[model samples]
Target: MRILVVGAGEVGSSIASSLSDAHEVVVVDVDPERVESLTYSEDVLAVTGDGTDLDVLREAEVEKADVVIASTDDDETNLATCATVDTVSEAFTIARVEDTNYLDTWREHHGAFGVDFMVCTDLLAAEAIVRVVGLPTARDVDPFAGGSIQMAEFEVPEDSPLAGETVAEADRFDELTFVAVIPEGADHASVPRGDTVIEGNARVVVVGRPVSVREFARALDPESAASEVEDVVIVGGSTTGKLTAEKLVERGVSVRIVEFDEDRARELAELLPSVTVYSHDATDPEFLSREHIKDADVVIATVGSDERSLLAALLAKREGAERTIAVVEQARYVDLFETVGVDVAVNPRRVTAEEITRFTRERRAENVAIIEPGGAEVVEVEVDEDSVLAGRTIQDVMADLPAGVVVGAITRDGQYVTPRGSTVVEAGDHVVAFVQADALEEVTSKL
Candidate 1:
């Protein structure tokens, strides 16, 4: 597929980098610096001009593009870019917007603003935060097979019992499959074997039924229980924070919002009567202690600024908060925040990129979750008659596949299927497999 990505910002650059491996990608941006940076950093064509201009589109050969993505920071610019591209190209159009209003408008009319699909950044980020909060000890969570199957990533602390155990010793769940193990400071995730030892401060990815995944979460940290997570305190009343609180309220969890602006606090109180709203500086230790933020089950910092969010999250962690989740705009600081005691760091741009990149994947892929940036991915593919595993047992099919591919879970006719070496795959079975970056192309072609 030939993909044309507009606005070479973080989100657009990330999407281009991920797709350049499997497709011909072109990037358009107004800034010459960004265009040159993208040109040298990724294997894609970078055009320097305004994407909403006809001459620029012509220069980029927009008519020949198979897919056009508008990912500019400004919502109006992205919508106009999509509309402009639609006038000259028959390419499928996707627009990324931070405002939920545009998403709601597009949802009411499928092809509104000449866009076939729309990704709301704040909504995606909020959903990610809620997912992590729902599962104890889960750094990341993604649902597959229509939410019947889930892929969860967990960080093993140094004092955890599972830290030094081998994969064989930790294989106690009946419905879970260990997909990959990423050691501390590793650049990529590797397929785990029974004999592979899990080191402390490492991360593990597993796929299985939701119940089994929850059970595994308990195994990772027995002291943390999902049922015990009742109170949540949000530092900022940004859109992401508000949406997260709304979702948590739906789950019967008590929510509190601390906004620096009094008017915004009043507005939030009116919007969410069930939530407790306070107008004060979240950075003040006295204010935090007075509000009893230390007793909350979770403290989330989404204060719009990276430095502020980091400080707020760290302060919450220091104040005896059970867990802290910070919204990081810079992807590079995710590990730094986590290392400094933040329980989880959610990058909105990264989440939006993952959501959009899945649509450009192979036709058989129903859903995709990137385990690491430019690393391993967990993909859900429906097996057909032409698939390598259509009628063969997993063990027999393993001979034809590379070593990095691990079948994580399968679902047939909406029923969960536990994958085993002896399990024979059916034609219509939906298989979720973990594929390392080196084997992605070959594995996707076969599956």
Candidate 2:
């Protein structure tokens, strides 16, 4: 796909970096310094010019672009750029909206202007808080098909009855998808085949019926009753950390935030009097010990710096914090946290990009989320008649499935059906399959 991305701000840079792998990206921005500083292994053509000018877009061949994304910090600039692109091409246009309250009006009013999608980071961050507050036990959650299905992250505790159980051996959840298993020492995640035993210490990632995800989580740890989370300790007090604290407080979760920003600390102490706010560096073992970090059930790091966030998680883990969720913004630092045993990396920019791509993809129906290490996710999509596997059963079609891919569940209408040798996938049926980045093209080839 040819993508014309306007703006070189944080969101735009993240978008260009993420999409450069799979698309022909041409980035335009007024700042020559930012454009010149961008380094990408893949082809990313950067042009220094005002994005609102149609002539500049024409020079970049915006008409040939499959999609145009306007991500300038200024909302009016983005809107104007989107309007100009609409005049040049029928390509899909996405605008980074400023006032989140104007989303409905802009979405409705901009059809003639060719703005197809409105992305607001505030709303994206807020939705992240929503997921955490809604499911406090979940470390990470990916919404799909407009929240109809979710790929949720969790760990298989040592006490879990599923310690040695395999996906094929045990009766799988009816509405749930068994996604990927993140083993202890590998750069990649593996597909969970039935009979693939669940290791006691493995960081298992699952996709299933929302009820099944919860039930499976509870079934793994019988001691964790439905609403049994006692307390949570959050490391760092950045904007994301503050928002997380507010969300957790609203859910009645006893929250403690360890931050280095004294002013922000005082602000939080005043706003959330119930929360214990401490002004201290989380990487400091002494401060962690004084705060009783070892007693918390979950520890999350949302500090701005990746190095500090990883260090904080490591210190918390050494202090006996059970679950350490780390905030990771830079793509290069994913490995750093992985080595440091960080539970999850909340890259909202990547999440937001995937959300925007959902609107541009013409063939995909009701996509929910994208899984990491490239291409692994559980997608519940209707099989239109034009699809390749409309009349095929799972056994006949999935023979060439790659190592990191597997089918988990199939649904016809609202009823969940167990896949088998005789089960035929007809048009209008939805399939939930787990695929790795390497297997994605194959998964789509079979449609």
Candidate 3:
């Protein structure tokens, strides 16, 4: 497939990098330095020009492209670029916007801007934060099979009993499947073998039913796991923060929001009557103490400034907050935030990139998730009559698949099946597999 990606920013570059391996990718950016950097770093064509210009799109052969993605920072620019692409080509158009209003209008009016798909970065980021809040132990969580199956990543605490146990020894849940073990300081995650020992502080990825996942998480960290969330504190009245608070309030949780701007704080107070909104600096020790942030079950930092959010999260953690989740815009700050004691760091750019890439996947795949950014992916595919996976046993498929690919679970007629070597995959069944990024193409070809 030929794909043209506009704007060469973090999200655009990430999409280009992920697609360049299997498709013909061309990236356009106004910044010459960014274009030069992408050219040297990724296996794709880099064009230097305005993405909304007809001549520039023509130079990149947009008419021959299979998908055109408009990912510029400006909402107007992204919408206009997608409209321009629709005028000159029959390719599918995707636009990335930060406002939820545009998304609602586009969906209600049936592609008002000629965009076939629209991705909202703030909405995606807020949803990511909510998922982490619900599952406190999971560093990241993704649901598949209509929410019946979940893929979650959890870091083994230094004091956990499973820290030094092997995969076969640690896995005691009948409903859970251990897919991969990501050791501390490792560049890549490995598909777990029977003898793969989970070291202390290592990150482990698992897939299973929701109830079973919660049980497994409690088993890993009983002291930190809560049966239900009660008190919650959110810093920042930004769109992402407001969305997070709204979701929590809907779940009947006690919510408090700290906003630096008085006007915004007043607006939030009026909008969310059940939530406590305070116009004060969240980084101030006295302010946090007065608000009883130490007694809160969860602290979320969604401030616009990355530095301020990091500081607020650290302070909340120091004040005895059970879990801290910070919203980070910069991709590089995610690890730094985690290293400094934040329970989870959500990156909007990476989340948006992953959502956009799902639409560009093979037709057989119902959903695709970037389990470990740039490292591994979890794909949910349907077994069709012509698929190589139909009518095959798990043992036969594993022998034919790549080394790092593992069949996590399968659903037949809405019944969840923990796949074993003798399990058979029939047509119309849904199969979820964990695959290394480098082996994605080979794995998809066999499906």
Candidate 4:
């Protein structure tokens, strides 16, 4: 597929990098430095021009593109880019917007802005945060097979019992499958073997039924795991924070919003009747202590600025918050935030890029979860007669595919199917597989 990605920012570059190896990718940016940098960094062609301009689109050969993605930071710019692309090509257009109003309007009338699909960055980030909050000790979480199957990543704490155990020893859950183990400081994840050790500070990725995943979360840190999170404190009145609180409230969890702005706090109080909104500076340790933040199940910081969010999250953690989740605007700071004691750092751009990538692979993948930015992915596909797994047993299929491909789970007729060596994959079965970065293209082609 020939993909034209507009706005060579973090989200656009991420999408281009992920697809460049498998598809013809062209990236456009207004900054000459960014364009030149991307040209050298990735295999994709980068053009220096305004993406919303007709001349720029023509220069990028938009007519031959199979997909045109508008990922500029501004919602108006993305919508304009998509609308402009539609005038010259029949390529499927996707727009990435941060505003929910645009998303709601587009949903009411599909293709309203000449966009075939749209990804809302804030909403995706909020959903990602909520998913992590659902599972205790899960640094990241993605659902597949209509929520029946979950791919969860957990950091093995230095003092945890599972720290020195091998994958085989941690494979006690009946319905869970250990997928990958990313050692500390590693950029890529390796599909785990039975003998792979679960070292301290390493992150483990697993796929299984939600119940089993939840059980594994408890086992990861038994003393710290809670049956359910009862209270959550959000340290901002941003869109992502509001969405996160809304979802948590739906789950019957008590929520509190600490917004420094008095008017915004009042607005949030009106918007979320069930949630407690406090108009005070979240960074104030005295205010946090007064609000019982130490007793809260989780503290989320979505203060809009990376520095402030990091400060708020770390302070909350220091104040004895059970867990801290921060919304990181910069993708590069995700690892730093987690390394500094933030339980989870949700990158809105990364989440948006992953969502857009899922649609780009609509030919086979029903859903896609990027475990690590450009490292590994968990993809869900419906096996057809032409698929390699159609009538083959797990063992035979493994022998045929690349070494890093692991059939995590399968669902047929809306029922979970545990994948084993003897289990044969039938046509129409929804198969979820963990694919290392290098093997993703080949594994997807075969599956």
Question: Lowest summed-lDDT stretch of 10 residues in model 1?
Answer: 220-229
lDDT (tens digit, per residue) of candidate 1 on 361-432: 856988889987446889999999999999999999999999899999999999988999999999999999
As for lDDT, the candidate ahead, 2 or 4, is 4
- Winner of 1 and 2 under lDDT: 1
Which residue segments of model 1 deviate by more than 4 Å? none
TM-score of each: 0.98, 0.76, 0.98, 0.98
List candidate 3 segments past 4 Å from native: none
For candidate 2, the 10 contiguous residues with the lowest summed lDDT are 357-366
Once fitted onto the true fold, the runs of candidate 4 whose alpha carbons sit more than 4 angstroms away are none
| Candidate 4 overall lDDT versus native | 0.91
Candidate 4 clashes between residue pairs 3 or more apart in a chain or in different chains: none
Backbone clashes for every candidate come to: 0, 16, 0, 0
| lDDT tens digits by residue: candidate 2, 383-420 | 88877658887777666455665665666767666666
Q: Which portions of model 2 miss their true places by more than 4 Å?
A: 7-55, 71-90, 96-115, 122-139, 145-148, 153-165, 170-172, 182-184, 195-203, 218-227, 258-292, 318-320, 389-392, 399-405, 411-415, 438-442
Q: What is residue 160's positional error in candidate 4, in angstroms?
A: 2.2
Cα lDDT of all candidates, in order?
A: 0.92, 0.72, 0.90, 0.91
lDDT of 3 by residue, 10-74 (tens): 99998998888888999999999999999999999989999899999999999999999999889
lDDT of 4 by residue, 349-384 (tens): 999999999999846899998987446889999999
Q: Which scores better on lDDT, 1 or 4?
A: 1
